[model samples]
Target chain A: MKRSDYQTEYKTDLPVMVTPLPKTGGSFRFTLKPWHGFVILMACLVSSGIAYAVTDKENASIFEVLVRWMPLLLKGFIFNLVISTCAMAIGTAVGAALGLGQISLHGWVRKASWLITQFFRNSPWLVLLFFAMFLLPFEITIGGLTIPLPDWVKAIIGLSLPVMANVSEIVRGAVLSLPSGQWEAAESLAYTRRQTLWLVILPQCVKRMLPPWMNLYAILTMATVLASIVGVSEVMTLTGQALSAEGGQTYWHRFTPLFYYCFSFTATRFHGGRYIWKRNILLSTKHCLRGP
Target chain B: MTTNEEMPMVSIKDVHKSFGDLEVLKGVSMDINRGEVICIIGPSGSGKSTLIRCINALNDIQQGSILVEGQEVNDPNLDKLELRKKVGMVFQQYNLFPHKTALENIMMAPIRVLKQDKKEVEETARALIKKVRLEGKEDNYPGELSGGQQQRVAIARSLAMKPDVILFDEVTAALDPETVNEVLLTIKELAEEGMTCILVTHEMAFAREVADHIYFTDRGVIVEHGPPTTFFDEAKDPRTKEFLSQIL
Candidate 1:
């Protein structure tokens, strides 16, 4: 008999478990297992309702104010996301290169990676961003001709600088965690050292490295709102404009807290991760929902 | 190297290798014709493993020389990939890719390094797995197989490369006593089929049973070498007799 048929024949005495478990005290096992999920959802709705009721004094429906303000808020959120994603992409690339460069046998390459990483990590991000936006535009020159980058470009570079430092460290940690034997094994197969690192070691490190990297992405997304200080019109900036509007502004300005909360939450997309990825580590932000 | 008359497939001449100040292999040399099974028995850190590893340029040595089937080992001239293609190695740890299945592990070297035909490599890989009596375990990952089975898969993986010399680096030392038999049997079966092999092992009985000749290595030097019967029966070196007695 074939392997499958052999298994089936030998498994004749094994029990089949097709039918779902019977209801337990008026709820099924699957539903019972989702208690934490249900509780979180109920908690979210309750807090959102309470915040909407107490924080905003508008006599109109919360929905009406939201609808009027939605376009500008959405544009701001999309703007923030674009900036963060682009900056983080550059950060990751630079970081991986720096990490690899730092591990080089050459003293100069190691020193170069060290200095670059240190310069970004020790200094303040906001100061760098502000300086780049203001000073860089006037001071720098190429070929005896002075030219300036645009505001948004400077802002992205400045914001991305700090992120690159952290990414390099993370990449370095992942690379170092691999056993030395793994490298030797590849070498034993007569692969060159560089080929061994690229083919065998790096892919394994990536799988183990992704969780921390995703968490960093969340933190980076939150930090990118600082870009609005330079008139980049990120979510918080749009909120300020809506609240203190001269023209093309809505009544949703009075309900800034609600709109900001919803905007941040939705843009960050903090939902449905349990079934899809199954490796969530963040605790619930209940106070975030309940706060002004 | 073999043809009942040709140059030895591998020849090492006063080969000396060191790591920094720690000299490991000091003036060690050996030669083997094609299709001969030569087993190198040694105490720990005796450089038997390092000698075999050096044959394919796995580790570079500072002095003397090694030649594989006419190509100088440290030859700035030889293509490394081509040199490695002719000499396959099996590690004590099996070193099978944990993420890939047994069949996939066997197929990877052939497909990736040799660039062999996909369908042909698949068929050859299947045949190799069967040769090692791991027919039902092809789709299983290395982690899922027992140590003996994994080592056999590793051996089959080397066989898939169609190498002239297969270096076995203490291939059965990591296995359990019961499992050691299966692995030794698999290797013994290979030697009987006229595969050229260099086994670095402590299983003196298996080494005696399978090896055409035996060499006892100590402190990075080949102390004695002879036909297996003479080496085991009348080991002249005091160190060799002591080494054999302890392991036996």
Candidate 2:
């Protein structure tokens, strides 16, 4: 029986979602677009609002609880931002080196790069963070003077390790994606291998690399909340402290998911806007962009 | 040794090339004198493109000696950049760097390899752009230009280095029928101005018009060669006759 026939028989007035019939060979039909992410975000927000309204307390509504704590939470969010920025800077430099090494002519250099990338990439993030916390020297004694390293510095190093691996993947992928014609053309111009890479190849790769780089940055930003576990006093840790208060205990379960959902949506939106803007600028600025 | 002093601009002797078991060039030899234009014509896989590429040392032959301006091409100690500065090549695909504008593409090799003053190179680049009839496309990227315009820009780029000889490999083969004449005209202008040129082309009419000498290759061997008048009209070899009949 046809789907429309069932609807007519049941006398139902539900809106029908008519998707295209699947082809014979493949039985998969899933196409999620960029706007779908926004739709999902909006749906989450609306549902959470309805849930808050349904579970209204006598003394404090959801609005009052959020108003009381958001300012305090923002202070810690700043620290989270700082940590993420520092880690990204460190990761980018290290990852670029590894990526270049991955394509190095020397076999040992390529192997070393592969080993380093795999070691960090395959390990669990939490374990790496713990190792950094325990294994790193807390203080250095040089010439009878003591220099102490902060806990967040350790956290940054841990976070950057994974980011370094991911960025190396992006760089390698971007470099490989360029057509071989660019290389041959540069070579015919009498460009050295290094010059060909720096001038001809890498410049073309910048456009291909930007979107993934920004997406990785957004993911790294979200992962910065893990800094709280190492006693870095970031937003998540501060939120935990706020919820441990006497009256805060009542809203703990609701507030945690609410904060996470909001933060995730913001990061995703930042990434989406940034990727589009970067691609547009790259397209427009072809004349101004020059290679080494 | 006196003959060595007046050596041809490019000399390829008994060049044999192979990729795995497939031999592409077998015992092919040619001498290209200064200010002479030679057009290599052949069917597919006849080593026409390979012969021109070998002159620039783009493809290394297994058994041969290729001398460009008396410099041994295969010599490890010889600076390749110096040799390439004297030999420029244009591809069939018009492989312009997408990131650079037409002017920048022309200016790149001169400023970078020659270490010439940027201002001087830019001036020469602009002049060459005008010579190629692409005066208004100075600021346009390769992606923005049509195939004919891009090929002209590529010709301008190869001309920028002031090379002794320029090799064109099926340059107009990728262009539309309407636009092929512009690129061909640009090359013809260069030829008339006494630039040493070796072109591997399928355009029989253009070859007849522009070529000072025509080398017809068949199966990695130059089976027939002469001035355009005699080569086209009074060809004697059976293979050349058969080849001409098939094409004409």
**Residue range B1-248, candidate 1, lDDT tens digits:** 23334788888899999988888899988889888999998889998888888888878878888888888887776677778878888899888766567998788777766778999999999999989999899898776789999999989988888888899998888998999998888888888888899999988888888888898889988999999999988989999999888877
Error of 1 at B74 (Å): 3.3
Predicted model with the maximum lDDT: 2
* TM-score per model (chain B): 0.96, 0.96
- Candidate 2, residues A1-292, lDDT tens digits: the string is 4656656665675665332222556567576455665675556556656766666445455566667877878777777778888988999999988988888889999999989998987888888888888898998789999988789989999999988988888888888898876776777788878988898888887777876887788788778878888888888888788766524444444554444455555665555444554433365544344321
Residue-level lDDT tens digits of model 1 in A131-208: 768776544687898776666677778777877887887778887887775665565555665766776677666655
Provide the lowest-lDDT 10-residue window in model 1 chain A: A279-288
Q: After best superposition, candidate 2 residue A104: deviation in angstroms?
A: 2.3
Candidate topping DockQ: 2
lDDT of 2 by residue, B36-98 (tens): 999999889998988888877778888988989888886667677777888999999988988
lDDT against the true structure, per candidate, is 0.76, 0.82
lDDT minimum window of 10 residues, candidate 2 chain A: A283-292
Task: Give the true-structure RMSD of model 1.
Answer: 8.9
